[model samples]
Target: MEETGYTVGRMRPEWGKGGAQSLTFVVTEDCNLRCKYCYVTHKSKGKVLNLETAKKFIDYLLTSPDIHQSDSAVLDFIGGEPLLEAKLIEDICDYFKIRAYEEGSRWYWKYRINISTNGVNYDSDEVQHLIQKNSGKISIGITIDGTKEKHDLQRVFPDGSGSYDTIHKNLKLWMSQFDASTKVTFASEDLKYLKESILHLWDEGIYNVSANVVYENVWREGDDKIFEEQLKELADYIVEHDLYNKEYCTLFLDHIGAPYEKEDFNNTSCGAGKMLAISPDGNIYPCMRYYDYSLNHQPGYIIGNLEDGIDFDKARVFLLAMYKYQCDDECLSCPIAKGCEFCQGFSYDESDSGTNFQKAKYICKMHKARVRANNYYFAKLYHKTGIKRQNFHWKKELLFVLDDQYASFCSYHNEKISDQRMDIELVKEGLKFAEENFMKPVFLHSEQIADEYLTDYEEVEVLHRIPIQAYREDLPFYDYQIIVDDTSIDLLDKIPFQSNIIFNLSYENISKLSDMMEVVWRKTDRINLNLSNLSKTSDLSEYQRQLEKCAYKINEIEKHTGMLKELNVLTDIMFIKEHEGCPAGEDSVTLASDGHFYVCPAFYSNHLPSIGDLKTGIKIPNEELYRKDHMPLCEKCTSYQCENCKFINKRCTNEVNVSPAFQCKKAQIEEKTAMKLQKLLEGRYEFTNIISAKEFEDPIDMVLDGKMMRGYF
Candidate 1:
């Protein structure tokens, strides 16, 4: 006998990693019993996936290029009770394995036959034989809700007799043969059994229990409080028994309860679009949930058929367009929306309109209650273990433009009219000023300076060297950053440091940025993308498109390579929750070659009036105007990741605080694009905050329309 590869004590399913392709077979719609909370509205012996239908679907699935793209496959079997068709399932599994080997498919060895049964027929000798035959390649979960009382409440027969006695008899045998796990579902009627049922499952040696409250709109007014209290009770029981690490329950995860970065929250909860399901009639859906048997009002959404293959348009609706329908502005912008769950199929079925996009939020209150309980569990666990969460600190830095040659298109500087170089003495004086003002000093230079000269100003914390080709091994600076322009985009390979490279692209080269976005993530993490010259000719729509492409590129790299690199323009907006825009005069000031201090290097390069010279302490005539509070439109805005450059503000709006329509539109583009990116990367990373989708496009328009109050005039 082989070991069966089953862990005796613990079994946890991998969530959201996205490698395997799931193909579900509705083995038969017939069952021995009808559970009250079952999603399948119609069940009959006539609707069975016959041998011919199963073989045809399996052959098509194994031979299809789109289906074979996954490294592995999961052949999921489900029905009113899949075990009723145990022989058909066995034959299907055998054909799938043999066909996969015949075609030399990767799934020949990397496939799982997963059957979810209602446990009445689980003890059948035929089902037992099938399990033994494919012991190594199969996983069969027997759905037992927990304590006999709880299980009997909903899982009853046609005669209204409880089937718990029959299921309990096989638990010992089931646990002995497999790493047992069960699916526990709770509806409003069974709320009180939630805590004891979980503990009962654990006591019965079923350590891993995947559980959830129903997602339908059946939740009562005060059911959330009961759900929360039950979970807290379960938490106390697990903690008291020292079973936090040993037992598994989906409701009490450390990652839930808290708000995540907006981008990190999942767009859709279930694997609807990705997972394929075949009905007995040879029709295919994105998942079993989309089948007519599972839905309430709407007809089955068929994405493909055995003869015609997949309809990409229907599939795209599930994969790409479904998310837009599944959430509204309120749900998308919710602070604690990270772990909230929604079923796309259910949303489509329950939608008032015949649209597939509108999400049905019946589980919103339940999710909130779950989040609160999850928080309590973690707080208790951390208090017991004496662990603390880490906090983030934002530091300010001063930019010293070494010379005018390197000043073109610096993140702040729009243009360079002078080529005057800052002497070694002026550099040291600027560093001294930075040290006195409690700001980190950064040196920006166009040409490489002598090693001896770099050694002179050791106070320079970071040297942002322009043109990636300028780097050399003998350079004294070991931990400096690089800034790449359009001229140096191809020269990104010349960069020696992989960590701190910034690709500074201006608005004029937006198309070029899109062209090279595929290769940029391989070199740098941050992109200081901004509009150096926001002219009337600039099309806001085109910029939005390009910026969105860059955002998608970041998500693609993370999805394929599992390497998460940052792209500042879009990613920054996702992480920013408040208005923490550019800190020009407040925290950082620039020292020009002429020994004059300006708000930033852009003011110096463009020959704007200086705040003060190096001879006297820095002093701005009206410093309050540089702050966000003075700018009414900016103050009301939430695009905090935007730089909100004061130089551009003064150039376009003729005020330091007020932003022009161009600036506001660009910020809005980045902010909206960030929300899209967040949706793209939802399952890949766990974010703690959100880059919420704003209701308006441009904040300036909001002010003009009298929707928002005016700021400093």
Candidate 2:
């Protein structure tokens, strides 16, 4: 809480130098009840932070003399049940109060004191009195999921009976005992229970509250749909009851949209190291991840050592690494640029790479969902925003066709191929097989990539070597594959034969995207936001290389797609090294973002079975699957915006044409709903074979309905 215009609070929170300003005092973790969803193992095994740790932590908190003036350090007393060690909590509180009087102002150093507890046990009167003495600073946060039945089903005592009633009774008693507001929260398997529980709490006269959706064993907010609807319903209810202006805060809402507290409020991205967390285990982690076993976390990473021995500079370094996960090139140019924050430290704990690709995929899907939602919002908000968009109509824009192929070509740039780590022969075979059997001539986007490092290669590339970008400056690559699709095809003639059907994407709104459903528009307080944004953050050298590899493949298809199709071959023809000018060798073309040349990235930098090493120019196991011939969903299911990935088979399931559940469930839903969408589209214009009212269980079923049977089926 620095003065206006000077917001660098207390020279930055230093670890070790500042006595443990943030104390998480865990009383005896041993508890009477066990939650089935508890991340930690039940029958508690970890040592509770005893009174000794508590005292030293207080001593540490006292050292933060500068911040103490502005705000006291936070002392969050957590436990299996803080009430289990109720006396210790009192002792700790009393210790600090007495110290404040003895040391004068230093003892009153902690600005906030919070206690997390399971409300099965009634809080002691002494504890209540201590809270009152603190002048409303000590608000106890408690848990209550819903009606007794669901609550018991989720968490229970050792005997396995539902403990909801006991907890509710204890909560009522605690609320009655303490004059201050209690924040009653819920953790429900189904969000419906959360709503019911909040209603129950309101009925009990405990109007003040805060709620957080509990992610499962994995640190996720679970299903976004159910979570959003339930939470929004909660927000609307609070506003209706005039409880919206209270001190209660919901992070779920804060994430999507928080209260507009400041005039400068803007979008809040993930602030991983800046918001920071130090586990009771003494290891430093980013944000809300206090519990999780990523063994690399050490005491040194602690932002400030409780014993006044830790270093802040190192912690600052840790913060820098978090937001800047060095990965793919998508961050710079992706439409959803703001949605690129990632935490690599957590990945070091749970994933093979320090950066979690799986989580990235989840984030990507969620971001795509967010884009869809924002698009809808943008349309509604800016309806007369008459800027023409990509008219994905039947008009045969050459670039659009190439762009379609570019979008459809599953860029397998970084997928780690199985076993064949250094198979040079396979690389050669794949290159040869692709070139001779599937040769083509096409125009490529030969845009010059940025970065001053290319100064070294300019001479060689320009004088004797082949041009990278075909001729276009906006494109990254140039003449490599097809000549036909990019040619001047008659648009009027193509439109007469083309299916003007309202593809499933017409009905594919934001709701179809499970990650982003609502928008909160809350503004977060800044620490050094615009100066240190999420873009320029990271230390992950490995994932960066991998990401550049993927971007390379995407760039490759984007540029050379025209040439690839002219020879009656797909974009990634297994081999192409035999041709004189075709760039498909050890380092024929470098990734645009990162100047590294490798095989296709889907084999994850192992490069696809090399073109020159193949027995035939067609060396892929199921080459047809890479076409419309093998895609069960894409052939029938009409998610025009959907990215149908052949690389899905090789990367996720090792089958080139195999569709993961992600594709099957999502794509089919869009396809099946196209009929309803037809009703909407018909009003806009005359319709054709596109609006056939046939139910499709999957994309293959759509083929059974005959959307296109000539060349595709």
Candidate 3:
């Protein structure tokens, strides 16, 4: 049977947004240089996007109801080297410029065009003339990786002599020809020497750069240790130099430093298939990464008749389908959900399947680090809301991250190489980003800055305590952890949690643990609920008084573990529904797993005690990686919401209550998600209570301080 896995929920992208600000037009597949990592399929193909089809694609794009809404659009002419088919690109741009005014307001809705070139064959006068004519409408995105040694390591001509001189010369020529408004980007393999690369470009008199990371797994895997180390190195470097300074030009940095009020970007999801891309052959695609459905396998030049071949919506569905396969691991359920990639794109896979073997392997090595982050994030929950309850139960020797689903999450954390689904689209501007950013910076150290600029900005986590609502006895392992008694905790302590011991404990552990601790919703209880009637008053009349009486109860159901859906944060919210920030769009509520759930493991004000048990069938191997007290972040973050560590309580710190690394990362993601939600819903409502990440010192302090920062009215 073909497993569709389980039905995750429907996604609802914010309407009216579509297409990227940039689009790449392939001029030709024929290249003067041969980089091995180039698309595997591009090797045998001698195809090019012919002139006529290119024009039609542009026409469709200009007239596209979907494309025009973007703030601006840039046409990036790419190739095997865009200059190889420079003449075709010229024709395409010339045609668009001359016709741009001729078409309706739709055609000129602020569209700017650009092209990407390798600097080979770029000095021709005629080509320069055409570019001069349409320079206002077009800017070129170029590739220049490091110095001569690095550049030649990959980008070389047919016979293999380094072409750095010619490329730089042409780059100078391009710089002299265009002004700064023309979006000039410098790309490379990763985000390494951005400062040096930018300075390098500046030395050549070019201003404006857009850096990108190379995406190749073309989809292959196996370098889990290497790539993770590479990324970790980069992140450490970022932390070391504080390179991601609050610069307006750097979007990621800008986002990182956004004020609490400013960080809110209401919509959490990107508009996938909406914004369309038009290839040189006039076939439309969601973005440049996709092969043109109209031209990918074309045996010859295609022209004029290309309009008949594109299916925009179907492709959208295909890509949207990929997201469904991701995030079933532990990160999503962790209190901090947004900082991580949420999908396999960050790591390459063995095949087209979207498995992150690196994610599996690397996560195995450093997941404790992330659990540290999750705990750190959960600690922030308390810092933000100022509610206190035990997340990590600290016995004399063991710290428990008390959740049920953590086993699988821990297993998936390794960045496994799987044959699951994959994202086939390739990000075109990889090399340039690496070249510009990864190069070393000689001047950054000597540069003078105001003391205020050097000031420290503490990072904060967004914490979520979700409650599971539905009842499902048939499949009862959603974050279920055997709440063993002190004696049982001690008895189990001697078991040495190997797979065999885990297997042995899986059977009787549930009932045995039940005798010790209370779980959220067992099927035996009739009052278990689902999505439709979440408000306790909405239940029977007997429940209404109880719901109204307590400090956090909804109805007769004094305790509940409602499933935390994609739309909302806590599954079993105890504080106040009014206190919950707001739904993260309707679709957000649906991402939470169904069946019985709990409002995080903290058990502060929730109805349900806890959820599933790890002994059943979760994938966590090193269980100690999930505890809050096991983490360093928990000690630092006092925010009640921020410190409500899920993954920690469910797994890691369970053995020692000390945090692992996952807690830190989870904190960052939650903070980002909350900021995103705040940005998204800010103008629509006027909520009296909301806490930002910056206000708190740490989880312990947040609890001590109690939640009135920002002075909620």
Give the winner by TM-score. 1
Worst 10 residues of 3 by lDDT: 438-447
Error of 2 at 244 (Å): 7.0
TM-score of 2: 0.41
Return the lDDT, model 1, position 172. Answer: 87
Off by over 4 Å in 3: 1-24, 43-46, 59-72, 177-213, 218-272, 275-284, 292-309, 312-322, 325-713
TM-scores, each model vs. reference: 0.58, 0.41, 0.44
lDDT: the better of candidates 1 and 2: 1
Residue lDDT tens for model 1, 599-673: 987787777888887778789879988766677887778887777778777877788888777677777888888
Q: Write model 3 residue lDDT over 1-713, tens digit each, in one string.
A: 12221100111221124343555576766777775445424532467787777777667655756444455555667666677676677777777766666865443556666666676776887667667777656666556764555566666777878777777777767667764312222223423343444445544554343432333322124333333343334333333443322111221211111111212222222332444455544555544444432223222222223446445445445343332233344433333233233212223232234332222223322222232322333222223334221323211110121222222111111122222211111011111111111111010000122122221212222211111221123321112222222222344332212111111112113233222212222222212111111121222222222222221221213224442112122112212222221111100111111222122212211233333322221223343434333344455542233333342333444532443344433333444344444444445445444535565422444444656664542
Residue 675 miss distance in model 3 (angstroms): 26
Q: In terms of lDDT, which candidate is stronger, 1 or 3?
A: 1
Candidate 2 has its poorest 10 consecutive residues by lDDT at 524-533
RMSD to truth, every model: 16.9, 24.2, 20.7
